[model samples]
Target: MKNTILILFITLLSVSCKKEPQYLVKIEGKQLPISAEIASDKTIEDFILPYKEKVEAEMNTVLSYTPKDLVRIDGKLESSLGNLMADLCFERANPVFNSRTGKNIDFAMLNFGGIRAGITKGDIKTINAFNLMPFENSLVVVEMTAEKVTELAKYLIAQNKAHPISKQLNLIVEANEYNLTIHNLPLDDSKTYFVLTSDYLQNGGDNMVFFKDPVKLFKLDYKVRNSIIDYFTEIDTIKVELDGRFTKEN
Candidate 1:
């Protein structure tokens, strides 16, 4: 009986030892370059060829033509490219917002940093639109009171950067006071204005806190990139110029 009990104990100890856990060993190395001498995988190439061809064809499709090059330059209160984009956004989004909410878009505002690239003086392709506004920001309308509109103007004056504003706005910065007009009229402190901008800006991007807590927020479900593409497709020739929409005087 003793010998049988001892044999059972030894068996249990052996099973527990066998069940001990093991750890994984890690090895790290730098990525190696892929050489042209590598054998091409025929199956993979055949699978990707059709998709590649379709993408190339779409990107190369001409949408419109620009008479002159529109560039985003530094230290300028406004640029041809910025004016063109802001005007296009307002034009495209106004009708949509009006139809949905029965209110017209008073003006449009966009950040200067958002304009990625300049449009060359030549045939404008779909790829150019994508390159200009790479972000997938959607169009949004913020209904703000007259007080908030004043805040908006102040923010612009303080920034003193070449941000894009629609033609509807005529802002003149004086030494201590700012003269702002929307649609060629003075801002009414009791009125509510529908301002068209990107969802990013509406959410306080670029320190535009005045856009926050608006009276009404309308999402247009329209991508800014798509709006540009639509505008280019509709117009045969794209003409843009700096018209001194926002000016400073001491």
Candidate 2:
């Protein structure tokens, strides 16, 4: 009887002392967790999660490939000149022509070493693009002129095959020597030219000395990688296409 009374007393005391939740619960606005997505019937994980998983899967898949496939991947880069074009054209040479100036621009110049991987004879994946650029670069269009362009070409011609990364323009060679029109064309020193490129090239880190801006017109808020991703995504179902803009000539 005494034990029962003691237990009952303790239970009643515990119940009486129990505190309410300490949270100052406020009914703030709520959202349904909508997210930016690929917009498809296919299932997709979240940005960080799915991105992580797909990368892991590709990593594993690439690792298991045969030596023959590996050779093709490396061969595609070695045997072709796209590496040179992509390297020089895309790096610091993104051009946006202004209608006000009537200044026509050519293909964005980037160099080969900047292109770090091959397309592997299959659909290019997100990881493939990442491996290509791999740097924290953004597209910057700088206002330049025909004279500055001419000067830029002269500098490019002097580099020869010893150089790799592109600073302003893609150079195609005829027998390990470049004999091209874009590089030799006359440039007007008086006309303002807008060149699109990454900040890295603008800062002159890519050995592109022409990035010296008398004036900078616009800067992109997007990363170069994201821009590449968006660009590849919209290429009409062809995830990766090599036009061979950089061709071999005898």
In order, what lDDT does every prediction score? 0.92, 0.51
The TM-score leader among the candidates is 1
Q: Write candidate 2's Cα lDDT for 116-220 as tens digits.
A: 665454465667567767887776666666666666555655543323323223445565455434434434456665555567776776688687763655665
Relative to the true structure, candidate 1 reaches a TM of 0.89
Summarize candidate 1's per-residue lDDT along 14-97 as a digit string, tens digits: 987896677878978898789998889999999999999999999899999998888877337888889999999999999999
RMSD of each: 2.8, 13.6
For candidate 2, report its TM-score: 0.51
Best candidate per lDDT, number?
1
